[model samples]
Target: MKSLLSSRPVLWFLFLFNLAVAVVAPFVVDGAQGVMTAVGMGVVSLGAGISLARDRGRRVSA
Candidate 1:
């Protein structure tokens, strides 16, 4: 589970999927809840992507 979540492809997919959802959520769902959920997902995936990039940078520099 941890490895899967940390994978670049997974993070990329999540980020893109969440971004699409955030864009479409308002029309498909009621209130701010759907948009909020997508935003939360985007944040999580964005954080994961940043962490992955940072780790890769350290590896190359070291």
Candidate 2:
């Protein structure tokens, strides 16, 4: 798990992929629910970004 997270490309890929999905979600959803879908995605992406950052910091400190 630590090895995987230490890979810059993998971490970046996960971050971008989640954000991209969030952006595209609005188009895939129906009606006025698009806004809600987008917001939810944004939250998920943000959390992932934070987690990735913390993982990197731990690696650096160690």
Best by TM-score: 2
Model 1 misplacement above 4 A = 52-62
lDDT of each: 0.75, 0.79
> Model 1 — which ten-residue stretch has the worst lDDT?
14-23
Supply candidate 1's per-residue lDDT for 13: 80
lDDT of 2: 0.79
Question: After aligning candidate 2 to the native by TM-score, how far in Å is the CA of 23 from where it should be?
Answer: 1.6
